[model samples]
Target: MTKTARLYKIERLIRQRQHVSFAGLLAELEVSPATLKRDLEYLRDQLGAPITYDRELNAYRFEATGGGSALARSTARHELPGLWFSERELYALLMAHQLISGLDSQGLLSRHLQPLLDRIHELLGPGGENDSKALMKRVKIIGALRRPVDATCFERVGEALIRRQRIAMRYLTRTRGEVSQREVSPQRLVHYKNTWYLDAWCHQRERLLRFALDAVQEATLTDTRAKDVAMRQVQAEMDTGYGIYAGGTRQLAVLRFSAQAAPWTSHEEWHPEQQGRWLADGSWELTLPYADETELVMDILRQGEQVQVMAPDSLRAAVRRRLAAAAALYVGA
Candidate 1:
């Protein structure tokens, strides 16, 4: 058995019997005398377990009442609170916790997530006991082009979303280089591609729209309740696209990735409804539904010459124009 499991069982056995002999503990834990003694010492010293041996009885038991660290106090006469977890499961939980904690460093979601993180830490046992920091050190998530979410804007948007209320905000559109005041009824907050976006019903446009959380310059909740868009409508309009740029119209976009990029692009999840096939020339052909080509074009351009827009003349033309404009920048230089 693992040391953690053995330690937990040893504590349970001693607590159940109120006083357990060394022979009984050794037999139950299936550990050598010295290993069992070391385990007991760790519990007593490092964990602050109030353990004392009775000379007359020749058995170990709690001090009836002893005070120390929280772990020590809790496990004084009881088992550890955290349920046993396999190494793999513990790693998954630890990675998720770390990812969430990292994203919250800007304080955007800190207030909302503190209680949740605290509960998880408690259930996982103390960081020292679990070696959470060591586990976290082995894993890392890198966001190549990441943006931070605004804390004040996020707080207001989250409150409005939870209450199913409308909010007024000044949002900046990078494409147009304009900041417009809008009153929108928030439907959901989406964190996609390491960015936070708000899917809402735009009062000015009289349609559903997506606004980046970071681009929200100002936000305030309104007394008006939000309009409820059906789940079916939301999925059809928003989820049918390649990325956050969604619309009512949907079209199939075919893309060809060269052999060099195929190794990575073939394994990528570009879209849910995407279909892919390997060509004889060692390239990959991918088909996906898209409503707006804005985000799709950006993804394609990021791959440079390794990707090509195979079909849908409009998308191809758009990409061609963008590449030409970008190439012109180096012409003079």
Candidate 2:
């Protein structure tokens, strides 16, 4: 039996009988005397279990619950909570672990969550303790496109967000080719397309900005409490538009996908507030609001001739120019 299982069973035996002899524990656990002794010591020292040996009874038992004894006065008895799980529930937990571990490859999240993961393995029943670890081997996470976030920066950013405090950051906006120092109140953290983003109210710009974590050169938590913006306002300004670009939406991009592309485009959620309908001819018509066309335009170009920007001349013209530029590369090839 695994040490955790043995420890759990030992506690239960003691609590049930109110006292259990060492020989009885060896028989029930089928472990060597030395192993049982180690388990008992671990239960006391590591788990804070207030287990004590009674020489008169020649057995082990919990210290009385009341604060009368020295052991009871220092620490209360610890109980290992029951972990009963249906097969399906266990599978779901394992799946969630796999996915979370994939998203958190750096062990940033895994370090804090390892204890809970251990408890999960202990639930595998008896000596099947290795089962969860074996399952972990079978499940693979491919993070080829993942952009690594600095561990220190991520922690400070997360701490400031949870503590409701402002943070100072030296930001590098690659798109603009500029580096600026700013103090911002982190409103939310977004993990989209294999990267982390901080949605914050930029103090310098005095507007909402989505700063990619990869672009944050440095972060320092501040004592000043974060400026709180209502969720409704944040959603309107930050989320209403397509992708990560932020602002109150200025225009809607209406698109029509060919029948072949409709099958896929109709089912995709390009934006939270997007509207889509199937035309009589089996094409898909999608209209979504956007404050900036930068991201929306790239998505359109990927479809090549399979999609068309149906409305708003600006978007159509932009797509045409991109297709023209891309085709120009092959002009003399």
Best lDDT goes to which candidate?
Answer: 2
Clashes of each: 0, 0
Model 2 Cα lDDT, one tens digit per residue, 1-333? 555557778887887677889999999999999989988886777667788888887988887677576545324445655333444465567777877788756866667677777766655543455666677778887876788899899999999989999999999989799999999999999988778899999999898889999889999998899999997888778887778777754898899999999999999999888999999999999998888898899989888888999989988899889889999999979
168-236 per-residue lDDT for model 1 (tens digits): 999999999999999999988898878899989899999888889989999999899999998677676
User: Where is the poorest 10-residue window by lDDT in model 1?
Assistant: 120-129
Q: What local distance difference test score does each model get? A: 0.80, 0.82
Per-residue lDDT value at 47 in model 1: 57
Task: Give the Å error, residue 205, model 2.
Answer: 1.8
Q: What is the alpha-carbon lDDT for the whole of candidate 1? A: 0.80
Off by over 4 Å in 2: 1-63, 67-79, 82-90
lDDT of 2: 0.82
